[model samples]
Target: MNILVAATSVAAVAFLLLSSNQNIPESVKPGSSAALFALGTAGFLVVSSVLALLRVKFSRWLMLAAALIFFGILGFQSLALLVSSGASLPAGATPKLWANVIRNTLEIAINAWALLSAKASTFFMGNRPNQSSEADGSAAAQL
Candidate 1:
């Protein structure tokens, strides 16, 4: 169980790296693409990490929302690929679409497992009410 959580954590980090290479419109500068990808991927990872660790309802909702977003992107890209004559998009569009589809698909699966699996939910939920309060009280006492 712990191994599973660790695995997902590693995946989150890998996602950071994978996202760095996402395709950007030519109109957007190269530097902006890096920054945008970093921010978006890192932000999602950080938030998702926290949400999963807490094992709150928000985490469940977040997983659902993220899946929807990824699915939407894939759907849009598939549409574009069908209709596009390679005129409007950059030459890299196909690779970019596949890259996104793969990463998003992986993330959606991992997140769903984190949210829905009882073992994962228990692992993330941690020691729950008692542990957090005790730690907080200890810190407060020290302060």
Candidate 2:
């Protein structure tokens, strides 16, 4: 799951960065270079995935950090979408906003999924006896 998240993060960031060079996505662009921050976040997420895969003790926190960033982006976009006038937005802003919102939401979900999988187990809870190795574990567990 972490691998999936990491890979998708890379791909998404790449696509956004490349596309933003031509036309900016409303959700990801707080400024001219804000997409660069998204790319940097993706880079961090990839590193955290690698660390979690290797059972690094501190990596779970990194996972949470990335998740928080995704959640913040998604949450803010969702709120903005709820209140903002679609007619006032730029041409194609609606689709770009929706796309970024969905993408960020999915990445947040993947982070949650990875946090419970066997690969990232050591990163969170220590080596305790018999934790369930559920892929998409506990829908209730969110941070």
Candidate 3:
């Protein structure tokens, strides 16, 4: 989880750098796209950290959702770049494209895991008296 957060942060930074490059298209500029990406990543990090610190059950899921959304945007941009390039992806595009796909897929899966975990937690914790009751209900229901 920590690794995922770090990776997302790194990706956001990379996107900001790429978007800032003068050689890149104006549409891909760092203004809106980079800012949004950074904001989302930051939000994910904050939410995840707070939940984890507070021992909240849904922290992982929140982080996962954020990761998915963040990487989803990047994947969409990559696809757009490929399309705009007239399907003539760069000579070394395969490795990078596949890498991005894998990363995005992983992010999606992690997000899904988080979602499931959060849902399960919420289901058991619903209207419970306290954390102990929630835990007991969850354990009892699991069997």
Candidate 4:
């Protein structure tokens, strides 16, 4: 599950990078890229969530972070689309390109964090069952 999430994150980032290039067709605009990235991110989130619900180790934070990041990007994209269609802002409207760029930046950051966290957790678990068990015991004791 961690591997799957990491792979999807990498693919999502690659898609976003490729779609950002001007050489790409206008049909593959930021919006389309965002949509595709969101799909991949959402898939990862769903899979991770299931794993977490099953009490899978190391997935809790990664899943929550991915979900937040994907939802944030989705929200930003929706707002940009609405604004582009002449939806009025109460005060001043954010520029569409800026909003898109911000969303992409945040999505990248969150994905990277999730990947790193998953990797760290895997490494930590792979070599240290005793440590994990002790930690779990302590946590349970505290509870």
Evaluate all candidate structures by whole-model CA lDDT and list the values in order.
Answer: 0.56, 0.65, 0.63, 0.61
TM-score of each: 0.44, 0.51, 0.53, 0.37
What is the per-residue lDDT of model 4 for residues 23-114, given as tens digits with 9 covering 90 to 100?
77766444756666656776777777666555567766666676566656656666666667564643345565456667656655665675
Ten-residue segment with the worst summed lDDT in candidate 3? 127-136
TM value for model 2: 0.51
User: Where does candidate 4 stray beyond 4 Å?
Assistant: 1-36, 87-143
3 or 4: which has the higher TM-score?
3
Candidate 1 ranges beyond 4 A from true positions: 1-26, 29-45, 70-82, 86-93, 124-126, 129-143
Task: Show where candidate 3 strays beyond 4 Å.
Answer: 2-29, 49-53, 57-61, 117-143
After TM-score superposition, the amount by which residue 140's alpha carbon in candidate 2 deviates from its true location, in angstroms, is: 42
Q: Which prediction has more favorable lDDT, 1 or 2?
A: 2
Clashing pairs in 1: none
Clashing pairs for model 3 are: none
Winning candidate number (lDDT): 2
| Best candidate, TM-score | 3
Number of the candidate with higher lDDT, 2 or 3? 2
Steric clash pairs (candidate 4): none
Model 1 C-alpha lDDT per residue in residues 25-115, reported as the tens digit of each score? 4444335465465355445555655665666556656645644454455456665674675657677787777676666566667767766
Order of quality (TM-score): 3, 2, 1, 4
Clashes of 3: 0
Q: lDDT score of model 3?
A: 0.63
